[model samples]
Target chain A: EDQVTQSPEALRLQEGESSSLNCSYTVSGLRGLFWYRQDPGKGPEFLFTLYSAGEEKEKERLKATLTKKESFLHITAPKPEDSATYLCAVQAGGSGTYKYIFGTGTRLKVLA
Target chain B: NAGVTQTPKFRILKIGQSMTLQCTQDMNHNYMYWYRQDPGMGLKLIYYSVGAGITDKGEVPNGYNVSRSTTEDFPLRLELAAPSQTSVYFCASRRGGTTDTQYFGPGTRLTVL
Candidate 1:
């Protein structure tokens, strides 16, 4: 079976605070790992896609890094606008379809 | 491109009623997917299609049916709505072959009574 777990279900940070969200997974085979940001009453927005271990991708103040068993999304000097639900997903080697197994998500709130 | 779009942004249905949530993409992606988001549980895949005329179930497909008749549209059908079925449905699509980015629609908020 495949499973994904995210730590620190809820986080509150000061405007200049820096922290990282964790996504741990156990999959049969890993094809790709994805990071997304979702706001209330809206759909998720794609952020990064890391394919292999030791791979990292960044966008603005957000950075994503992936290892064999887990992935981390690091936010540097976050702002109030960066407050949203951060989602983590993994695509496992499937028969044919690319079904993503998602984590419960980490709710981030940055106070200005 | 408009990315992915879903119709009936919000809906309310009585038990046993049926509804179809429409999703379309202008990106010409070959893959489409349907998922439901619940409070605190994250997102669960309902169904997916690799291309036109091919559809398959995901982890939670018991009360859902999907059809991909064209490369641009994939709609999810709820044959019998129930209170437990109340959720926010999302549709996503992406380019085929090694494409990891799946663009999502705004989502449909469904309330079953």
Candidate 2:
């Protein structure tokens, strides 16, 4: 079965603190891994997509790195505005359909 | 561009009732999808459409139906609302490609009694 798991269900950090959220997966064949940020009562916003092991992508203060079995979303000196639920999803290669397996997500709160 | 947009930002439906959640995208995307998010849970795929006249099921498709009669719109239909169906529904779209990032709408919060 294909599954995605995200650790540290919830995290509270002081402003300017740095931390990393983890997303691990077990699938038949890895096609793509995606990261999204969702705010309260709003839809998710796309953040990054990691296609292969050793692949990394960055934007502003966020960086995402991928491995064979997992992915990491590293926040660099995060600010309060960076607080949001970070979601991880994986697309399996053999699934004919473009379905994605998603992790429950990591809720991040940065207190100023 | 309006990106992806869903109507009825919030709605309440009694048991056994039915409703349709409307979604439209102006980006001329070739793919559209519907998902439901429960409290503290990741979004579950309900249905998806690759293009007009083409629709398919996703991880969670029970109690829901979708149709794609045009490239710009994809709507989700709930035939009989149930308490278990109460959730935040999101609609997303992307240009047809494996690596294309999905663009999501403002989501609709639905509650069932």
Worst 10 residues of 2 chain B by lDDT: B94-103
- What is the TM-score of each predicted model, taking all chains together? 0.97, 0.97
- Kindly list the per-residue Cα lDDT of model 2 for residues A3-106, writing each as its tens digit: 99999999999999999999999987888899999999999999999999999999999999999999999999999999899999998865445777889999
* DockQ of all candidate complexes: 0.81, 0.75
For B16-90, candidate 2 gives per-residue lDDT tens digits of 999999999999999899999998789999999888999998878999999999999999999989999999999
* Global fold similarity of model 1 (TM-score): 0.97
In model 1, the runs with Cα more than 4 Å from the true position are: none
Residue-level lDDT of model 1, residues A1-112, one tens digit each, is 8999998899999999999999999998899999999999999999999999999998899999999999999999999999999999988876666778899999999999
Top lDDT model: 1
lDDT of 1 at A66: 94
Candidate models: Cα lDDT each: 0.93, 0.93
Q: Which pairs in model 1 have colliding backbones?
A: none
Error of 1 at A101 (Å): 0.4
